[model samples]
Target: MLTKKNSFSILAIGAVVASSLVLFINSTKKQESALPPARPNIIFIFSDDHTAQAISAYGSKLTKTPNIDRIAKEGAILHTNVVTNSICGPSRATLLTGKYSHLNGYKLNEKVFDVNQPVFPEELQKNGYQTAWVGKMHLGSLPNGFDYLNVLPGQGHYYNPDFINSKNETVRYPGYVTNVVTKLSIDWLNQRDTSKPFFLVVGHKATHREWLPDAPDLGAYDNVNFPLPPTFYDDYTGREAAKDQDMTIDKTMRLKEDLKVHADYEKSGIFNRFTPEQKKPFYDYYENKISKEFDAKKLTGKALVEWKYQRYIKDYLSTARSLDRNIGELLDHLDKSGLAKNTVVIYASDQGFYMGEHGWFDKRFIYEESLKTPFVIRYPGVIKPGTQINELISNIDWAPTLLNLTGTTIPRGVQGESFLPLLTGKKVAWRKEAYYHYYEYPQPHHVYPHFGIRTDRYTLARFYEVKDFWELYDLKNDPQEMHNLYGSKGYEAITADLKAKLKKEIIHYKDDEALKIMESKL
Candidate 1:
């Protein structure tokens, strides 16, 4: 059986067999490596002062937002989602760091954000994500965590607004702010690195103060007269903080500056922000026509207040219409680009606005209208369509939730736990009450700074800084917070329990100023 030719042939055949085995292993390895990562791309659409009352999915009858509602129709809606500060900058700061405003140190809009701090986007960037923010990142300093940024300076104008680019340069983009913001977001999606996952924030300045609609959207709700909220003339009899505030729809909402009386708000400089194309139509309808009619009627007191309410509600809803339309554009873009299947879309606001509740207009209180924010999210595979989560969610929990969504371990020192489980209807342990704090006051709205706690059925708060007063309400009984039960004879035990909870919450958040308020409770 042994021969030189036979031996050589056997050796060659064995070598060929070994080579084939190696090739197959290498091919399998290549295939496995070529698979896409499990992490989903995130599109966070954040709007300024867009209340759930205006969102039709949240059961608003005044206006219908088909596109924004589409997100809820197909995804999940959060009923008790709230913000830590209920203002633009602090809410954003909390969202970025997954921590309280005190931890982030951007407690109020007046402060500059410390860019050196670790943020969620920076963590995402480190983990191979391409992060960007398109519009209205109102934190005072330039954004540092994102790979790219085109943010609006300060509050941002409705038309021809200036955007601060990644290079610390402000560039003016001429268009309605909503449309321009959406365009930039789409443009970024087109140009972003396709191999890596992306996180894009399409921040909108719509439905904010002055409530200027797009030129095309003006007079949208002219036919419908929005009914006044039953509590529109809140006498503030029981709540002292409510009486001390100045953000009323009638008294504080300026006619020349806010309602656009003569279309020449040069002192506010909003009219100058508008070009001729915008000014001409705006003047013809709002100034020349509506103002003339308003003067002809000579309405006073309650009638005048009612007129402002109608005008205010119409313009606000009209601006919201444009916002929803642009949201539609982004949703469609996701669908056509094949990104929707693997991406997560979220719609939320910095905070909720009054929408004429309690005759007030601005945020900066721990009341339900101002404290709560709307949140709707869509994930093709993970979230089943039309899920509603009534579990309480705070803005501070945002970053940890994103990290958890990507299957990453949430970083240390992050205060908020991931709420991803809530989306799945898991019966997981969650917080019982939401803690709130507001520092900005005396300048803009004159609403006193306060810290408080909101439970499932009760709201307990302390209005501090100039005076000290405790407020308590059983939300089940007085859902509008019309009755303050503090110092009442029968509810001392309930008030004591809430105060204990508030102290724990303040310490948990590590807020030094609020700790003093908590100590004073003793």
Candidate 2:
């Protein structure tokens, strides 16, 4: 008995009510699942030649690295390691592209990295992330795809270093390289776009070859006599290939050439320019020591070699101490700015360094000392604090991980897998083994070109060019890698399996250039 007008009005009211209800429900659902505010900023503090064994968080008994240790304490420490190419420039290239050295076209220090290729930073920038790189980007070519860059040219000097800015202008700064680089990094962080997320890379030049510390850190480790590594005096007797090498710390280390120490008679009156007040510290630290050791006893032969090792270790640790302090400053900035809660902090080195292990001082070997890089990451919301992952990860994995964190798609042709699952304690299976190749042969260090595969239980390496030999080791038994079991009686099956795996990896990674080189020599 309702009229037509009344019926129409009633139907309109019902429709309006249903629409309002649906809108409210949709709004609530969106509010609940909005992707947690787009993720936190990322800060990567990368150092040159810093070893995993040098960090206290990694169980180093020799030196204390509280600041570097904080990253592990706050985040996850990757235990099983990866390094595609172990040299400086090549390793860096791998880090940026998630590809091997040959794939990235950066094989050695003498070779230049092509910047036109797609790098990780470029992907981040495309995804609305502000990226900046400060300090020693030791890539052979200048950095590209960064919103801002302040990098040093090859093997940058410790004092008054030259920095290339975004405008491609090379300018010299008048201070210790480490301090200046840190200051620049902090300044960039302060002035970055706060509305958008940022990715900052702070590269430090501490703990490289000919280790030099800042003035304040000069006598830091003087009182501490570092314990000699068990293999500090290894004669390389059983290994003919290792014995013929010229990288021994004792025999190859020099007094005047390598150490840069001289007696009073040999002093070229460089200190004469300084006042007595300025001269006091230098003489007190150097003169007495040089006179007592070099002038009086004339440290040479085995005695001189031991002295060099002691000096090298002390200076290297001292430099690392300064790097730790500066890292604390960056961390403090994040905490004060309320950025710590949402920021991802990562600390890593270009490659591992040898600290008198196997009686050597420099890198460029597929050996354990030179192959294992230090990697630590901290993400407050997504990652659990103090998490440790034992999965094998390579430097190439860094790019894909960063891309995944930013909700960006990783491009094809990159060889690394995203490690975000491992970061969050997710039980996802990753690569069980890692592949490494070193290409700088007959150059510096004279280490032959080699490629190898490292599994959880063993390592198999094949050196080419001059020495066509295969070396295998049970990493569980010989963690120091002292013995070679390539031709041993009991390990034939293990060796064959690892060699087959190595071949698969080489082909999978598309290391065609390496394959061609190796095949031609064979």
TM-score of each: 0.93, 0.91
Q: What would you estimate as the lDDT of candidate 1?
A: 0.89
| TM accuracy, model 1 | 0.93
RMSD of 2: 3.8
For all predictions, the C-alpha RMSD in Å is: 3.5, 3.8
Worst 10 residues of 1 by lDDT: 262-271
| Backbone clashes, candidate 1 | 0
- In model 2, what is the error at residue 187, expressed in angstroms? 0.7
lDDT tens digits, residue span 334-381, model 1: 999999999999999999999899998978888889988999999988
- Name the 10 consecutive residues with the lowest summed lDDT in model 2: 263-272
Per-residue accuracy of model 2 over 1-522 as CA lDDT, tens digit each? 899999999999999999999999999999889755665789999899999888998899879999888989989998877688787888888888889887888888856789889888888888888999888888767767799988987777676778988888999887777888889988988898887899988988887766756667767877887778998877775565577666777866555434546523234332233345544555555556643556776666767777778877877888898899888988998899888988899999998888999888878777888888899999887888889988888888999998898787899877899999989988998887898888786766777778888888888888877777778888899998889998899887887788778878888888886566545533
Alpha-carbon runs more than 4 Å astray in model 1: 1-37, 265-268
- True-vs-predicted CA distance for residue 236, candidate 2, Å: 1.8
